[model samples]
Target chain A: MDKKWYWGIIFFTVAVNVIMLQLTTRAYLGREFEMVLPYSIVGVVMAGIAFFTFLQWKKVEYKEDEK
Target chain B: MSECPKSRHANKSKNDMVNLVDNVEQKEDLKFNRRAFLKSAVGASMALGLSTVPFSVRAMMGLTDDEEDRVEIIDLDQLPVGESHKFYYPTEKDQALLVHTVDGDLVAYNSECTHLMCPVFYQKEENKLLCPCHKGSYDVNSGQPIAGPPQRELPLIEIEVVNGKVYAVGRQFRHG
Candidate 1:
């Protein structure tokens, strides 16, 4: 896979994290547990995914030079 | 020494397969764990939403938004003489009490303590409404505070018995 593909995934995960964070705050303020729980879980999961994708991007850039 | 092309091709393919498996097992970290996350998120949200709903919202949810004028209190046969039932009347925030003083005689009143808004429950043994907060007591028959800090009577709840069912139709508060 191209190094650029991993970068794109990283950006996408970051976007997801931001959106979920906003949703979580709204739900908390509204005092709607129906929205808060799901949004918090999704936000944390997206953050985890983003961290892992960043690691993948680093691995892609520093691959061994094939002779 | 000359290597056979077929054997060389086979060796390369096996190495590629091994590398592919290793990459999938160790380095493919961006895989979205959709199934597990979805299961946990949905289960948690539903459990919390159902359990933690505020009392007011839960009451509103029980009755449809359009129909707030009338609320069913209880069944007539369920209330025997000398027993009282606590329920909501007029609105979800308003509490009311229903009692069958005697055979074929049903009475209802707002259960809030007129002095401080504390909930009042019927004491069947004493046959009076007792507010545990301040020991305020209201007469079960007249709803007038007979003892303690209460200064007024509990609002009367007009009850309607339709086809063996009891409904709180309206409320009457003390004038002046």
Candidate 2:
């Protein structure tokens, strides 16, 4: 429920996404080249979800402080 | 744990408005530290997991072995004096090219691109081995990659002519 906890979750999610992207790129390219298109798309989706969740948590925390 | 009476007594007169704010800020700081510790643990484990995937896949694909030795023999007369032929070497999965150069010399090299393992095809007009995947080129005579992402020369398959029959003796890894 804390801001730090939410930030941790976001960082964890981003780390997982990066690991997945690296795996996918290595599998498809047989080398650590740039992230491929499909992996990039998935990473963007995961990051968007994390950002949206963080924004919603910030809004709730602001409302609680006002009350 | 028992609290020290001396320290407790000393703290009785130290209270201030700023200390209250400091206490709240300290609680947040502790939470952030805990979060950071957890994140590092998760990141390390995830990195370990990610690194293992490639090794596992390589093992499954038979690419994990350091030695991928192979040999093949082709007929000298069949190769002609200025032509080339594609042949599978010691392993069917490994492809190679036998080229009879314009100077009337026999040469053989692996057909897989060093960059990404794409199959390299002989381009007669250009007199080079071309990878369709990335447009990489290798010299037909020397098997040296001349263009594209290939950083190493194509592996040469050593050959010896025995009774006019070409025999691949060993293989050599070439790097620029």
Candidate 3:
């Protein structure tokens, strides 16, 4: 709801994306090819959400600055 | 310091907002530290889990314990020279071909073809191991691929005959 909370959300989503990407890479190294696609997709989705939240946080910051 | 009650209330709200922002920052820092620890812990555990799995699979794939290393496949009196006994050795996952050659030498080898992991059987009439999967043929004596798509030799299992019993002692694979 607040600008601070949006920043937290961005941090969490970025973390999720990073962890998912790492898991996907590990799965590849382990020869678990079946898992690679699903984890990569999840990581990508999380990254997208994180970027969207970052934009929203920026808009809120701009509004605060204008006030 | 004769501030109005309204101004005092506004000041209190501002202090609360600052406290909230400070709390969020503190929680973010804690989360970052916790995530770092979790990342390392997860990485270590994942590495440990992946590293130990293959050994367990190999252990399950008929690499039996030492006390049970000697597999009593068939009786020497029952298996005559030039005859072959198809059985499982060390573990059920491993198929073995225990053959008594015409020269009276007892030899055994893995029954899986090296080409595509197809099951190989002793063709006693032909005196060779034949893989019906691709018409692959292997030397019964040396377990070498004689005619087939296989480029590797079949793994050999060491055999021992003591008294009237035939036992498979150990196994050796061609490593290059």
Candidate 4:
């Protein structure tokens, strides 16, 4: 995959996670809900997946360059 | 007497080694300073950000508006058991609901959904408060979202009962 695409995906994932966190906190404040923990965990997992995928993509590029 | 070539080479190598050591020490110092600067910068920014939040929000999870003129105290007997009464407390624009649960616990929350600020309705059949706009369900007792997109627990309004009269005393904002 293209490096730019990988970077774009990373940025987009981070942005989405941040927006979700903000919305979650706002909702919690408004309602005093307890689901913020689960939402945060999901956000963290999504971020990890995105990061892992980006790293894998970079590894593949490195291997290609070596060849 | 001319210095031996070997001695000159040895001196040159020693000078080079000294320069390398100095360069390494400088780089290490730079790294330490950079880290210290970033840490302080981040700490300062975080403190500023936290302090900037509105005082009303920072007070407590259940403290409402401090403005006495905007609060309207209602009687508890006015609302029957297993039913909810919608009223405006603190401000006319902000609507709140006082729900008398089947178990006889009185709970108060903002009738607005935490997700999109849409009004939420009490569902007697489901025994859950429903946010029709987003299908969010909140447990009537805790004002916690049991399902749907809303992540925050409902803002809890503190109430006091005296001689059958209910007064909206404070509001609490709960976060996860």
The whole-model C-alpha lDDT of candidate 1 against the native structure comes to 0.65
Model 3 lDDT per residue over B45-120, tens place: 3343344334334434433334238778889999998888898876898888898877778889888887888989
| DockQ per model, Cα | 0.06, 0.03, 0.03, 0.05
Candidate 3 DockQ, CA atoms:
0.03
lDDT of 4 by residue, B7-52 (tens): 3324433232223433547555645653344344333333333332
Those runs of model 3 whose alpha carbons end farther than 4 Å from true positions after fitting are A1-67, B1-68
A1-67 per-residue lDDT for model 3 (tens digits): 6966765665665566557656765554433455656666665566556556666766775576455
Q: What is the Cα-based lDDT of residue B141 in candidate 3?
A: 83
Q: Per-residue lDDT tens digits of candidate 2, residues B7-79?
A: 3323432323213333548555645654355455445534543444454454345443444443446668788
Model 3 lDDT, full chain set: 0.67
Docking class of 1: incorrect
Give the alpha carbon lDDT tens digit for every residue of A1-67 in model 4: 6766655555555655666566556544554344544555555665565656556665765565456
lDDT measured at residue B161 in model 1 versus the true structure, 0 to 100: 93
Clashing pairs for predicted structure model 1, backbone only: none
List candidate 4 stretches off by more than 4 Å: A1-67, B1-72
DockQ of 4: 0.05
- CA deviation > 4 Å runs, candidate 1: A1-67, B1-68, B102-104
lDDT of 1 by residue, B11-41 (tens): 4432332234334452333243432343344
